[model samples]
Target: MIMFEDLFQSTTSVSLLVVLVLLVLQFFYSSFSSKQQREPPGPKPFPLLGNLFQLDLKRLDICLLNLSKTHGSVFTIYLGPKKVVVLAGYKTVKQALVSHAEEFGERDITPLFHDINKGNGILFTNGDRWKEMRRFALSTLRDFGMGKSLTEERIIEECHHLIKSFEQNEGKAFNNSQTLTYAASNIISGIMFGRRFEYTDPVFQAMVERDRELIHLMGSASAQIYNMLPWLGPFIKNWKTMMKNIKENNEELKCIIADLKESLNPEMCRCFIDAFLMHKLKLEESEIKDSQYHEENLVNSVMNLFAAGTDTTANTLQWSLLYMAKYPHVQDQVQEELIRVIGSRQVRVEDRKYLPYTDAAIHEAQRFANIVPVISSHRMSQDVIFQGYFIKKGTSVFVLLSSVLYDESEWESPHTFNPSHFLDKEGRFIRRDAFLPFSAGRRVCLGESLARMELFLFFTSLLQRFRFTAPPGVTEDELDLTPVPGLIFSPPPHELCAVSRH
Candidate 1:
């Protein structure tokens, strides 16, 4: 009787356990289904092609912004099979990148960048490696006076070189792109290698030229196609050219690293490379394995800094000049401020506060240029329910910076180039929350401080010495403001005569 009773109880318990397990499975399935239902809404994506037919790949930022009008601030869009969630406008972008920062902070390394970077470098990396490298770089930059007087002096010196290059035009029509890039490149070079190359150096010119081409090619339609379908790489002409440029640039960087390694002294670190070498040596001596201070990280970080440090700042400065030429009245206001405040003296970083109009003009140029329309996409670090939408972990997110910069709600004149956007009624320079040309959050431009100093010193000094105007036959209206679309929105190829003010 006892055995039979026990057997009955065991059978009952087994049945109950099975029933409980089924209930648990059903609960989870229902939860997951609900979450999927809550996923951000989007235009119906066709199989295989996704939403490719709906998007303008060339002007993706504008297209996404337009889509946001109907789809709401945060919406889903597909590129081929890949799904991207775009965060549009100032409020949405700021919320995603700043409020829920950790959730939306990872860099979404597209197939193309992944192939090139191989999960290395500060630009397109995440986790501890990225954290370590970024922390080190920021510390090193501060040590070298990134925002301090040391950097100010470096930028002021480069201003002289850039001025000399402009003066070579003799008030004649000439492309200022190369010289601007060279000047910008030299600042990063000084930080990296502790030396600047002459603008005329063939090797230096080649490196800068190659870097510029790389930036342009990276934004080409072929590059976009390659990212969506990497198997088509060989057939894509731009892809082929980009790869060649990368290979060449990598080789050049390796050689520079090697030379720096030979003369690295622990007691006296000269620049970024030397500092990195010293850190690596310390790690090795302490028997630390798997250090993030490896050569790949160093080289890739240098490349990231070099490319980013050069391209965007140069492009903005270029656009500033173009805007000055286009609106002579605005230029006159800026130059007038410079003369009244700084009068035949070197334009120093300290002078910005005194020259509010000039300061506003510079800020306006950055806002108007919208140089990096959409920054490198940020990947969701974990599953997040953001603003009532379920975003799965690892989902790629595009913060449409163009939308933020040109948001109708954010700016008084969203479509016009008005310096007063950054100025108050009292004619004092006012900081606008929408001014995010360097982006924000964890992955904000690492060289922002340096870039700021460079812009103020370079722009002010140049304005102090010369007046930028359209070329001989070109009218201000005729000088094109159409941006050459790329990873950057560079002013279209045009000439401006830097007529000497003196």
Candidate 2:
């Protein structure tokens, strides 16, 4: 009977200890719950996956925008394990990016940006490195003729080549991909290498193709899946090819930079490379071990320039063509304006003032195309309590640009292709504060000025010479304005007949 009593007592003590432990855990969990309730509201996340299953892999921007309707302008969403605070609409995004620029100044180095950049270039770097590199690049680009007559001349020259390339198609339909991409690249190439490649250059063509592939991969469903399910990489081996292509391109660009170095003259400053080399040589004596003006930066900067300078302008130009083909009346009106204003003076940048209708059309095209769907996520440099919600330091913030670009409140015809968005009652060109195609704030596009010049010149010049029309058997209605998404949303691939307007 004593033995039986001891067994019961021991079992009772074990059960009591278990109950106490549960009580303690419940207390801590409740405290944790109380704290989290203070954080920005979001859809309930599941264990491990967080909100990964909730987000649409393909239409991420749309998903977030829709979520904003329910959760308000500021809300948290788990992008895999990472907690991302999405800021929607013009007021919210602008306030965070422009008004509170310093607070939201850092770039989020996600696994994708992490693998691609590996802590190099002005695009991904932060702190002093980013500042120094950006300053140098801006100064250097200006010196090499961004927003100036010299730069305008280069673009005009490229326009002539692009026109000739179109003329070669003999008014028949052919994809503008090769011609437009190559021509757009030459504008930047003229700065980076002091020369341009032929339209048929196989090596340069491959590079552009590889670059496109990478952009698509990063924006692909597979890439997002990899982000959430990285452990399954062995099963999805196709992604490895994307990585391989990146490595190969990097090496090729390095070789190009190395060759540029061999012929670089500090005194003359022939191109961006020459100018960088001169600065690099000067830096050889300085003991600043963390200097931004090194070979890695120089190479990555050029790569960034190529990626931004080439792809963006080219893709937008492609969008321009697609829109023009889709809306022939709009195209005709733009062509008429070009003929009336420019009249064959090589369509100089100075002519922009006299060509308000043409200018308005171009601006409308950029807005309607809206290639930059999502702005790069910015990071918090320090813990910030914005809009009565706490955001920890180093957290990623996605500025949903589509919310602003396509906002019903800001644009009179946000969804439709309407040039009058930038025109008054007089059909005179006017700039809208909401027309933030290049974005705003301190991190405004590095190539904004240059891109503007290129778009105007490339677009107007093409329209000035060629009356682009849908090929036979294809109706204007058939030419869709729907953008096939990429790093930038590219227009669906289709061809237009570039009939010479002689």
Winning model by lDDT: 1
CA shift of 407, model 2, Å: 0.8
RMSD of each: 11.5, 8.7
Clash pairs for candidate 2: none
lDDT of each structure?
Answer: 0.86, 0.81
lDDT of 1 at 283: 94
Which numbered prediction scores highest in TM-score against the true structure? 1
Model 1 local distance difference test score: 0.86
Listed in order, each prediction's TM-score against the native is 0.92, 0.91
> What 10-residue stretch in candidate 2 is worst by lDDT?
1-10
TM-score of 1: 0.92
